[model samples]
Target: MPGRAPAAPRCAALVGPYLSGKTALLESLLFATGAISRKGNAKEGTTVSDSSPEAKARKMSVEMSTASADYLGETWTFIDCPGSVELAQEARNALLVCDVAVVVAEPVVDKALTLGPLFKFLDDNQIPHILFINKMDQAEHTVREILEALQAVSSRPLVLRQVPIRVPGKDGDDVTGYVDLISERAYKYHPGQESDLIKMPEEILPREQEARTAMLEKLADFDDHLMEELLSDAVPPKEEIYQLLSKDLADDLIVPVMLGAAEKDAGVHRLLKALRHDVPGPEVVAKRLGLDGKDASAVIFKTSNQQHSGKLSLARIFGGKIADGATLNGQRIAGVLKMKGHAGEKVPAGNPGEVVALGRLEQAKTGDVLTASGKTPSGYKWPDPLRPLFALAIDVENRNDEVKLTAALAKLCEDDPSLSFGHDPDTHELLLYGQGEVHLNIAFDRLKNRFNLPVKHRRPSISYRETIRGQLKQHARFKRQSGGHGQFADVHVEIWPVQRGTGFEFHDRVVGGSVPRTFIGSVEEGIRDYLVRGPLGFPVVDVAAALFDGQYHSVDSSDMAFKTAARMAMQEAMPKCNPVLLEPIYAVEVAAPNEFTARCHNLITGRRGQILNFGAKDGWPGWDMVEALLPQSELHDMIIELRSLTLGVGNFAYRFDHLQELTGRLADKVVEQRQAAAAH
Candidate 1:
């Protein structure tokens, strides 16, 4: 035992939409595996996964939690991921390091569309996954109806592994047990206890046979021998069928669907057994990700801030064994920890395929590859983080807490890469971006509770531009006599709007040293400074200033004098030049399922958007991409409304396109707001 290589540990991630029973399923799995003597309830704040204070208060998971269990002499790690779409980045990173993912979902047909993004990600990455239909006892629809709805969103074939036994009841049809289609065995479920093996029911024999035949037919698509046996009308042995199912699952060719009610601990044992048999090991994933097999390497998929411990880096060992204090990439490992809920136990060494926390890997962040050779393989592709969907302008409540807030924000972004914050130069406010409003609220909570830094947040201000529609020529002089030398400088300048986006040009057309060659640059600088706040209380663009004539005192007229004079000239002329306000326009592309395209169109138009076009998105079947020109002011909170219309799956990408003139009551309101702010 001392010299033998440790049996590789397999890791699985439990992921799904919010309130889909992912945490409950995790509790059931832990209970079934004997990892815990008794199960814990999420509603009671007693579950191992949702152990954080925020999650306990919210009664839902806000982050990824890890646990380990030993079943049948093999060690396995389970990462229970948050179900909120706002927290999807945690699950996305967890999926990359996992051998397989268990996509838990409730049995409502209308909610099937919520899995569209998750399904697409799995298929595109070629990650092996399974569908666990949770809360089956309370399902309003039959298994076939649920499967049909789920299959519509998944690109891979959905193979039903079990057929549920239902009995008519006064409230509804109650699911009592299920028949395994692969082994053709039946069992009756007992709450909080092991299910008893029962004889196959004669009433459901025909249905069981039909479901078993369908499973074989789906598997036969990849296996020629199985197809030939099916064609010859010969029965495949049970062992052969199991082997085919395992191989197909490991290859990510089919999605095997299993049924269970996590609250009752029903069908959980069967699901775990299937995972033990079919889930691929670290070697398979390593080969698929194309990491170097010769060196000791691992991937840091998650980072967290611990109360007692400083920083914990959660990673999957890919190649060789790493012990405590192991030097990797020029940093010494502080400690090796085995995670159990929020608490961790120190471990000496971690082997390949094991999910363990390496303490004080401060330089290591999420999605970084660690290799003993101090280099990464060429073209190694880490999972790409999803684009941010919402943003808020944030600032410290107390001016003294600014530095502490900055450090805390850096740590927060490091813990969750999807969360980002930066200072907006135009608005002069610190802006924080995330997946949605709830995502930002959770971040604020973390800032307050974890870092003890209180902050305020609001919608970001729009960046508007001011330009002229009419031309005017004016002159001004600045003569100041404080004590010594007096300041006397005068200039005549023509102001007019040029073509759009031809921002701020200055012409030195003064003849015979009328304004003096030495002070020309200073005059231009002064004019540029004036553009910072125009007559309309916004930055001026698409205008040119010419210094055609001016007068100056030989002794008093320095650069400062000419600069002051130029500012005076521009300030005097801009208000009479017919200045107009310009609002930012963005080119937006909204992506959603085809059925929601019309709704998406209406949403854009309702926001005063101009439709460019709509069509099928490239490489995405049954999805539409609608392009439009929308005002930047309207784009705020658009994702919230969009998700509400499209079942929480719609998203958009936008960039600043151009500036359009604003008029009518909307323009008047903007001007009034700007004037009031200036007055304040």
Candidate 2:
């Protein structure tokens, strides 16, 4: 193994909670590996990651950024993913193709809960990941406490790879270096350079020994020989320890935690060295993804629409090689471009394990697997796009830009599948769905700056229905005289309330031809038209109308006269039927950490929800799923509040269950709003 060649070019994703310094870590990694001449600051808008205008203005990553570097003669590509929860789907898509992920975190116990969803996703997919505790220089809590908090959320066991070595400073103790737990060696940190090998400090020797023993025990759990050696009080050889560490990490049985301060370049080199040795190559990931490793295949993880280049599909080659103008998945490749953030260089070909942009793959979308044969491999799986939790009713300021807005939104949704837009049939609004408000705001910004189409957005309207409680029968006559032929017709219609959810029903119960068969159809058509806008100014449902009898003039009676007569009858009878508003109720299942279960319950109940049941969320440790029936009107901003309560890790899925009668002040307010909008 020692004499073997370096592994193929591998990819790693840097993922963590918001403001956890993933971009900073990416900069440090790039600068340390000589990919960049100088490290860039995210705050100063100089970082290679977060290069987009929206990201630079917000100083946060809104999408994933890809950059490649060379460390110890091995090529590595690192994807810096946005840490905000709203952009988590972007991170998940990038993680699907990577060989490993670096879960960056700050040394704060309270903020550890934010990593629950991210950790669950990595473990659930068996993706190998390392925990890098960034900003160790500003640490307030001990490393053990931080690890403990993280372990509660992670399903995999966390093993400490290094223990920070602190030295006395003018104000307080400073984390000057770290002691390697496996190698039993101490190194002193040097800013902007590799660490220096130093003698183990006697004062921290006991702590270092304890951490080393614990790491060894964790490794022994996966290896019988290592367990035997520990039981016999024999020290395992360094080679054997390294082998177990690599194997266990590749197997995703354990997460090795490393300490670092990316801003100062402290521990950055050490982190890179671990990645060079511990992370598996792309071949292993290819097998895990069920790729045959024989065909010319690539999986698209990200898509971008460039003004000049058109559509660029960022894909990781899984097998064989792809050159410019090659055919893949029945589509001709326009060109191959090597991507470094938003910029790209024309590449003649893309090889296995290298992430590159496939030019002009207009049909290719995120999570699409492309092969030369134009067929998807059997049983291949890709992560589904995350369910949208927030939405807005969007419209163009200039009606002339409607077509451009649609095209721009299509491109945006292609670039980030987490974004979606559609026309609501009931509400008749163009709704843009996404993870949160900030997520959609970034989309709005893209429409204005990238596509030259400015848009306006507002909260979406709820689809409220109107139903009747009482039954009534009304008679009406339509008579008009203007010329030689006069229009005259009479109708008697009975309206009755049916069971909830029965919808609208029309029946012709006429006998003895009291109303002619030709005119009866017209009478029912008028009733339906009237139902579209009920007396309460909403679509009417759960009602039945029957035309039992009517009179028709032999000479002047026509379809229009009968229809007008039926409409007049309904217009007079519906007000006496005691109309009521019917609001849609959804079966909502909220998933959150058990610690916040009580808060979730309060959040639901405070919104006029009825709890149905609560239980443990299957396959999710330390989490609970609370099921409830909540009205549609209460769910507009529920995600915003749920995240605020659960540290942005909570999410809910809901579907329309039934329609319930909505009475009282809330119903009155809804009806008033509907009538006012109708007048406008």
Report the lDDT tens digits of candidate 2 across residue range 609-656. Answer: 999999999988889999999999899999999999998989999999
True-structure Cα RMSD, model 1: 2.3
Whole-model Cα lDDT per candidate? Answer: 0.90, 0.91
Please provide TM-scores, in order, for all candidate models, with all chains considered together.
Answer: 0.98, 0.98
Off by over 4 Å in 2: 1-4
Q: What is residue 162's positional error in candidate 1, in angstroms?
A: 0.6
Best model per lDDT: 2
After superposition on all C-alphas, the RMSD of every candidate to the true structure, in Å, is: 2.3, 1.3
For model 1, residues 297-329, the per-residue Cα lDDT tens digits are 898999997545789999999888889988888
Please report, as a residue range, the 10-residue window in candidate 2 with the lowest summed lDDT. Answer: 1-10
